[model samples]
Target chain A: MYGIDSSPIRKAFELARTIENPINLSIGQPHFPCPPNIIDAMAEAAREGKTAYTLTGGIPELKEAMARKFLSENGIKYATPDRILVTSGISSALFLLFNALVNPDDECLVISPYFLMYPSMLKFYGAKVLTVKESFGTDDLNSFRKKKIKLIIFSNPSNPTGKVLSKEQLTALANLAEETGAYLISDEIYELFDYDKKFYSIGKDYDKTITLTGFSKTYNMTGLRLATILAPEEVIKALTTLQQYTVVCAPSVTQWAGIEALKTDMSSYIQDYREKRDFVYESLKDFYPLEKSGGAFYYFLKVPIQDEEFTKLAITSKKLILVPGFIFCENKDHVRLSFATEWDNLKRGMTALQELSKELAN
Target chain B: MYGIDSSPIRKAFELARTIENPINLSIGQPHFPCPPNIIDAMAEAAREGKTAYTLTGGIPELKEAMARKFLSENGIKYATPDRILVTSGISSALFLLFNALVNPDDECLVISPYFLMYPSMLKFYGAKVLTVKESFGTDDLNSFRKKKIKLIIFSNPSNPTGKVLSKEQLTALANLAEETGAYLISDEIYELFDYDKKFYSIGKDYDKTITLTGFSKTYNMTGLRLATILAPEEVIKALTTLQQYTVVCAPSVTQWAGIEALKTDMSSYIQDYREKRDFVYESLKDFYPLEKSGGAFYYFLKVPIQDEEFTKLAITSKKLILVPGFIFCENKDHVRLSFATEWDNLKRGMTALQELSKELAN
Candidate 1:
């Protein structure tokens, strides 16, 4: 009798799929095929006997590769293999981290216009959630100053909004967390997609910072179900014990593919995402109110009307699907449009959105 | 910084593996290759564009196949696609179920000498775990009736002890749950290894049972990371929402392979496990006092000396590894041995254990 407490993305998705002549655009999946080398690794692993359960932490090769990736690119230093735990995805990492950190009715703070799923994930575990109002690209450190929050989660390059945080903002947030004794869950899932600034990780400043990032956005291997939970040694041990009874380890074949992804030439794909990001930014000028996204695939638009209504109308008439901003937090007048699709689809979706805007204005 | 915890099977395993010429009697991994059909399917999926994020609930094909498999095997009536959530493994399913049902500090009743990881999983979620004493093959329904518990988890043909519940026992427990409003999480991971009786699912009588099982034991595909969560429609929806943000979905490659696992003939693998189960059941008879394990790939043996010390000594002297029983919530004098290794390894490990026992008697 759990009637659809339907997700905002799901609602928009359901409408788009069900409505005839639907131009589905609400989903956050990449349209590109997984790289051949990654897929080949998976196929090769299957042929070999790498089909047994791996250590709870992960296969050492994948963990070491991730560790090297962290060191060479970000200059983040951590103790060997023990500090990293491979998760099913960043989603799984959040679930596992919160389950380990938050007690029922414990206060967990999150930024406003957060990932729509945070409220539900925290609520499901009976965590008392408190949201601090935060605008994209703005330093919102003052918001956490007076709260009794046990944990706070935020995406570095904010999702949906696609606003990357400044270095000062990240340093301030890290310092605040160190002072307040609040564990910070920094979601760096979009680290590789930054448009303007170089990606900055908070792990360098605070050992308590639990970072969630994965191969989905960067490597475009979302379907492979690979991500890493990088934490301090103590936290990693706890996560390993927790994961042992949860997902065990991520799939062996997927891990093999992940290892290959870490070693491959990734600049081209990053460039591809940048191009798409720029194209969508340029096209949205006449269609809606927006700013160019700093990182990640989404373009959070301030729709001309209420998001719920705009989304419905767009699906039914324009045949274009965009997620309502209401799902992320409480930005009722905005919607999130993912530019991770093909250029043609983005073009078609934008055309439809423009028509819908004119009809709403009349 | 964290040393390995003393799990019943793990401790014995440490001892088993520690001996200079030690035999590894611990660890429950199968030596056989997973079905070639499953491997090929996974490779095929990886080759295609199926390596992106999937619906959190699962791929439609696998869910439908699981539904069919459940109906054909268990005669349990349920909706297929609508009622199933494919998880990374049963571990993920259990974690999700516990989080959904048990609030922090709320008492969750569990049978003793259960899976070693259960307490850790519960503690991670801040649940106050209480043990309701359960001995092998004993119907202790009355013990559970007196507690004001909110949830109870038990493995059928339980881990370490490998004790399966009878139809009457399962039915009685289901009725108890209905009476007390307590949820039941049936850890039926050993379903295919049942030797004494046909596996009787509690969900057959009770709609609220969240049954957890996977291919790790039956099909020897532990590393594949594929499992399904079968529940009433309501639980499925709640869990699906959790899974959506957590993993998005299990690995698409694993899903493809799982599709084949559901469709492929598993009788031969089941027969192989049975043979191994029988071999260990008989081999350990002259060595130590052991509980009768009718399912799972473990033999719960009562060591003559301190379980931990004996395990260490055996590993050093005999090259045999057996997991101590303390981790499984059993007496310290007991150890659990996995006979899931190759026949040669099993014979050698057992021989080492025998020699260590003789050496210890002096």
Candidate 2:
């Protein structure tokens, strides 16, 4: 049995539940309710008696829709329905991919400030996880290449830092993977959250890249639990077999709703988050050292004191919730603040964070 | 990376899809569609914007309801809400349990003929799986004790055979587990399908037993993907931590429906399967050597020829789909026949099966 600690994000969530009227900037999901049409689609599916176990991979219609989305949207031409494996969520996809690829003591490279699941899950699978902190430049790649990394993974429109990789950076990583005989996993769950139109999928240029995108964040249906994986045919085959014993299949009604999700546009919603990101960045840049996040909903602010201690003070004094940065990477001087809440709540959270930073300075 | 072949049950499903007007009996889920009340409950949950992720363990109301059900119905008084871990399905519950308990080369005893996933999944997790064929007698226990088995697992109202173990038999197994220091996993997904009312849950008397049950079999909501685990608090804690990465949580809307499911009675639906089981048993007993199933909706028949070859003949000649028994156990001369289909289709399937037996004998 492999033992793992409960994630610090979950601890923050539990703590926030105890405090009344918390300004919860620690949430990982979108604040918006799921669109009415998508909800209706799933309800209709259930009413129509489409509530039995689906094929082990997924329903054909959803898989076909995902294939089309990958080809026209992500510019991946090889993704057919057979090559697309619909999973419960991106989390489940990561679980399946890791179980299928990671061998005991296999060297795996993760771009740091990565999704917390990457390092934790890889280590559980007995992979020797090597972190390349905050850089995928040529030098970082050269240093990592010596480890003979079997797998390289990172979230695009990154999680804690919200730093979307440039095309040049993605190309460097892709080349490194190809030269070292490693598979690249591009977690693009936050692709729709890109603020500056700087998002680039490595799968478009490299066939070795496995592209993971999902409807949870984009449609605010995190509970519905649907995601799609575009990978090589052999990898898809292996994952499909693994999924049979694991997820069995994604929810049947949710698979039907995914067809409608592909048709629904979330550009307006993304625009709102872009404005929120700008507001948080501009307000805090003078008070604390922070970068204008290119995508996702988080701002990793460098704190004056230790990240955990600062978060504790924020919660105790201001009734604010923030995730300490030590969980996401090796850094202890940063904290992640999500702007994915309501506009009024976002404003209140920003004010609380500003006050906390000033207090820490004193 | 672990390599496993696709299950024979899945192979039969795939083959059935290719044929027209096939007498499909290869399914492992309930034949009934979800009840209207349960469907409405889930729809209401989704409409009320409860579509975001719930806590990894589960929502409070559903867990409490499951705890109550365990106490009143199964006599498991220790199954408090904190000890219940909601999962995507029983398959996922098995996945999490095996991953949490089975270290490399651990000796695990599986009661056979078993659920196909037991042996296959244990092997994938690097367990040295030991199968006790068709008996759990004193002799079997004595032999198994010598191997130092770390885990013992089986489904109550056994799949592929539909043999419900008596209370005495369950007590003996629990005693063996206690004496040998092996933890027992009782997969009671088919407990509600106990037509003879002879189902015995080991958790009622054994604190070391992990009881897995779900709404998928009872409510005909397999696609909704909700199951629960009752175990020792420490085991629940470890599984809960593992679930955070694997399943995350059960579907949000489904978890709400599960609360409604516990309130609803399912005896009428179970009675229908009881009639189906009797109908198939009486129709084919004279033609093939078989034992009458006490619960669940399956009959394991001794075929006159190879199980796989017999199944192929039935499919080609009569459009009947059946799983070969070799997948379930070491037996090669038997096949599993699921009677969980419509009355009219069941009649046609029995006639086809009888004719195939006659042809094979000739």
Candidate 3:
């Protein structure tokens, strides 16, 4: 009966509701609406009475589409439709995988500044979580090898810092997972948001890697809640069984829309996010200690004041909402600012953040 | 990591898929399409760009509507919007609640023949499950009192049995729960299908009751996957936090449709199910030992032979799929037959079942 506290990001959402016309840079989802064609497809599915439960894993059409997406795009030839288990979202896939694999007191390694759900869910299942910083090199492998880690997990084109891992880094991590007999879990929900076109799937090189990607972020259909997991057939079977008892299946109409989503090109949308990412990084780098975000629409800015204090001040003085970095990791000096808003709001939010930092420095 | 096997129901579905023209009496969901108006509302919501993640518990609109439904129809006065958690489905609601409440080796009581997930989920959380027969009298309370059961869960209009508990029976269970300090979870997903007009919610008389109901059965939207749990505010908060890390939120378009589902009248659909229930029961009662289902469009008929053997013969000889009772309970002398199909299918399926039973009896 251990209790889980609500995430601080939700508290930020609550705080934003109190502000009038807040320049909110705290959302993790795309600002754009889902494409019209995908929406129409979903509506058509409902109208055509495709509103009953699909099979436990998912409909064959969606799984086949995902299998092709994995092989052609991700370079993972082993991801046949049988190896893909469609889930409600990557969050649920992680939930199911963690439940299937992590036992009490099992050592699990998570890359630092991880997606908030990763640590929270692992701990919920009683895993002893060991976090390795995002900047870990090949030398980091030697230390973790002795721990016999059961699983290693991280989100690519990372959520808070938007730092995409290099191919060399991914290879080293995969090698480490192999040495330690640990399953690698790659959360590639931000795959399509890679501004530098440098995104690589660890699953392409590793047999034990569990790759999770979904339609939510790429298509701006987060509410539809559909995702796919490419894994070993044994893993897929276990997760599908878990899904049958948990989520049952992903939403049927949304699964239908996912077929259309795979067909809809998102290059223009990705281009817009790339421009926004560049704008946010360029505008803030001189004012604050920041790294250029290579992918995803976020800039983790190191603020002059405490992250929480600075966030509060920004909301109070400038009506801006930013997520304090403590919720994502142990870095209280950094605050995560999502550039996934309108161009006007992004500019206003960035300017407000600059003015607040100047005031705090003075 | 304990492995969970796929349920027998899924195996039945897989077997049904292999047959050319299977009469799927084993299917748990309604055969009817979702109402056109509800489907239209879902489509309209998607078209309106309501396709982003909602608040963890659910949208305020749906929760408010659920609160109204609970208060007016269920006589649950304390179920304000804040006390309700919208989940992917009742299965997910059960998952979250079980994760939140059940500790390792905790004692849990389930009334048998229970929904398969009840025992499986409880055991997944390491509960020592105690089953009280469905025909348990008030005297049965004395035996369970000493067991120190932490929770008691059962579906009203029970999934396998379809036997709606009398008000006295519900009161006795509630009183037993009160005396033992155990939380009572009343899954009322089939509340609308109470053919006897004898449905009663324990939440009306008990403070510790958690009432779960959903639109899946009433609106014929099993694939849309939306349900609500009316519980204490503290319990709701915990489940909501868990949901945020798991399913994230119920599908957004479906949540909008839920508001419409609440408004649409479903009496005609319930009447249709009632008639179908009568048709199936009357047709088979003389041939087989059957209890007329009081709710939820199912009959648990005592079979003339072993449950599995009878189910196999029916499927082989008659292209009929009936669920063996062993999946739902310890009894092997019974099978569950759903009467949720069309009039033609129900009639044909009933005749086939009757012939199969006679052949087996001979």
The 0-to-1 C-alpha lDDT of every candidate, in the order given, reads: 0.76, 0.88, 0.89
Model 3 ranges off by over 4 Å: A1-3, B1-3
Candidate 1 stretches greater than 4 Å from native:
A1-5, A77-80, A103-112, A122-152, A202-209, B1-21, B103-112, B119-140, B143-149, B175-182, B195-198, B202-209, B290-292, B360-362
lDDT of 3 by residue, B1-362 (tens): 24466889878988988999888898888888899999999999999999999999899999999989988998888878988899999889999999889988999999999998998989988889899988888887788877688899988898999989888878888988888888899999999999888999889888678999988987889999999998888999888878888889999999999999999988898899999988887898889877789998788888888999999888888899999999889779988898888888788898897788677667
Instruction: Show the colliding residue pairs in model 3.
Output: none
| Interface RMSD, per-candidate values to 1 decimal | 3.5, 1.4, 1.5
Number of the top-ranking candidate, with DockQ as the measure: 3
Error of 3 at A209 (Å): 1.5
lDDT of 2: 0.88
Two-chain DockQ for model 2: 0.74
Instruction: Write down the TM-score of every candidate.
Output: 0.89, 0.97, 0.97
Worst 10 residues of 2 chain A by lDDT: A133-142
lDDT (tens digit, per residue) of candidate 1 on B161-235: 777777877777787787777888888878877776667888777778877768776767888877888888888
What does DockQ give for each predicted structure?
A: 0.51, 0.74, 0.75
